[model samples]
Target: MSKSDFGLFGLGVMGKSLSRNLAQKGFKISLFNRHVDEVEVDVAKNFKAEYQELKNALAFDNVEEFVASLASPRKIMLMVNAGKTIDIVIDNLLPYLSENDIIIDGGNSNYKKTKERFDYLQTKGIQFIGTGVSGGEEGALKGPSIMPSGTKEAYNNVSQFLETIAARDKNNLPCCTYIGPEGSGQFIKMVHNGIEYVEMQLLAEVATILKHKGKNPNEIAETLDSFKDDANSYLLEITADIFRKKEGDSWLVNLILDKAGNKGTGNWATITSAELGVPNTLIASALFSRYISFYKEHRVQFHKEYIKKSVSRLNLADDDLLKAYQFVRIINHYQGFKLIQEASEKFNWNLNLSEIARIWTNGCIIRSSLMEELVSIFKETNTILIHSKISKMIIDCKPSIKRVVSDCVLSDVTTPALSEALQFFNGITTQHSSANIIQAQRDYFGAHKYQRIDDASGKFYHTNWV
Candidate 1:
């Protein structure tokens, strides 16, 4: 038999979809999954048996056989659980891997951990890549956005294979790029997830407001579909479809639990933003919203104890609602990219923001017309807030967001993410903020120093108060 060109470890949903994608792309690949006595026996065998595309695939229950099946300078991707399991898999593969062999971690892993693994593998004469694969199961089977980072040479070795299986933009370019060294790929993925959280919350808020206005799920779906031109996105498309889904006689979404679940990437991104000194308030508020959702009993109890305010229909036009949604989404992207920019500077990654935006134009959860616009915008400016086109768009949408926030407040609707997005934008754009008063208060309480507006000398001074 001919030697396989690639190997993949793990047989989970993502792993299986990606394997099928590679196989469909015409690469001979070796598949391996640990046999759990009666639990997961012959996963690789079953996968190959199930998919016609993987008919020529080599299925191995043994690690030695799996490694031997691959060609020299092997390319093996790990799609298993993140954290300690990754280390265990790497250790298991280390014995069989030769110098210059590449190992790609495609799980949602911490960037710091990816960096440590990269350094550790380098010492062993092996190459390591921390890859961010997005677009979920369907995208994985067809195409997904692929962010790969490592040494340039290591990335070059696998670029063809990765690009071949990645989603294509409208211009037919693959949504895959060689990100900067270390774990920058994973860092970008983490921030992408953080932005996703805020986007989801914004949609939920819109749905809540529309529901209060007597719009049924089907009507709400129609309204969402109307925003398909400029605001077209995978999440938006899927959300519209979700609203249209029915459970026999009732809308399925209404029957489902209100609480949302997360897999840690949002938390990681929020904490990382704080560590990097970037204001990702929209993302933070979204995370907190999820946390708040977990206390169903407490919320119910509070609802009973608190004075009930009448919730009325939101008095807003669809055009204005669209403007508000777009405004907040722009802010969300700004916060996410700002965190990425700060981390890039701090870590000396020399990341190409344009390239990052370009790759995100397709096969990613956050891909939209705005992201496509950002590809060109990032080439001229690092921040979207200052971009001429983005600035005009923000200026035009500002009034709508202000109106929406006010309406939500009057209607007794909660919009933490939207409200924070507006507040964050206002706070940053203000030439003279209330922060001076904060500095003065800090000085009064703890003897911290404050700088005066007239102090061109850039010296800090303490002032005594009664």
Candidate 2:
């Protein structure tokens, strides 16, 4: 019996799958968990057989003992909970781990926290890697998009193993990459989850309306069926199946609560966006919606407050809803790009937006057929996407889309989730606004200075109107 090459420090759903994957991929696996019961001898036997003739591998009680069991210059992955638990494990494990022993934090960790941990580990002369693993429980078992960030040496240490186990893009490049020096990988994944929030909310709101309008779940499922033919993502494609299927007797989604639950990544995105002074109102609103859902009393109060005022009642035809749905989807896409732009500026990450869309085509939540087309739109056009082919689709559907928006306003049909996104998209793409000019005029008149856009120093321009 001897130490193994790869080790998983947590054996929750994700950790277990990753361990099995590494073992199946022919790596000797050293697995450990806080709970001894989670580590089974039968599973150990399965692993030994899966990768026949492997070196001796065993599970341990805690991080201290686990790190002690590993060979010199060790490689152990911590797939435990993201925030507080990560710190606890790293603190305990740091004492036993020597230099060049790469420790991979493969969880949905916040990028800010990732950066902080990187700096802390550096003080101890240890290599710390933070990777963003997407594709839920199943993906973790088979393969997942592994967005890793840390030092160059750290990436090289485990890149080959990561590439072998990671999910692939259309070009088949392992979904794993050295995103940037540190924190960039988690930051990008944060945006990915934010986009996911908006997408699901948009679909849920649409479902709410359709169900209320007396459309059977099957009929709605039938509508989703065509989405897979040309342009589709995993979420939409699978949602269609969920609606199309009949369990004991109800739509699976209907069985679940209308309220959504997020794992803090989306909230992290929204919070970071505000910190960067970036406008991510749509995603912010979607995140807010989840919080609002929790306040059952407030929702009841809101209904009573506006019940007499006639709020959020849509009497639109089916065509209008479809057009609005398509337009809102485009808006969400554009907003996602805008957030990426702001993030790039803030982090100096130099992210390729189109490549992001491509990678997301299958492995991530925002994957869609339309993303392939949008990728080309980004390649050809250097300006705002409002003038691109995606925007042109909006243009063709403008009449009905506008009718829907107008209906939302007049009838007080609160299209808050979708409308806010559309408006946010429109506000950014527009060139002139009398309101902006007036506000700037007032600022210059009162303060006698306006911030200069192209100045080497912190200079202000003074313009006096007679």
Each prediction's TM-score against the native?
0.98, 0.85
Instruction: Find the 10 residues in a row with the least total lDDT in model 1.
Output: 307-316
Q: What is the C-alpha lDDT of each candidate?
A: 0.92, 0.74
The pairs that clash in candidate 2 are 232-369, 312-412, 312-413, 312-414
Per-candidate RMSD vs. true structure? 1.1, 4.1
* Model 1 per-residue lDDT tens digits across residues 312-406: 77778888889999999999988888889999999999999999999999988888888998899999999898888888989999999999999
What TM-score does candidate 1 get on C-alpha atoms?
0.98
Model 2 off-target regions past 4 Å? 35-57, 62-65, 68-72, 244-252, 308-320, 374-387, 410-413, 434-466
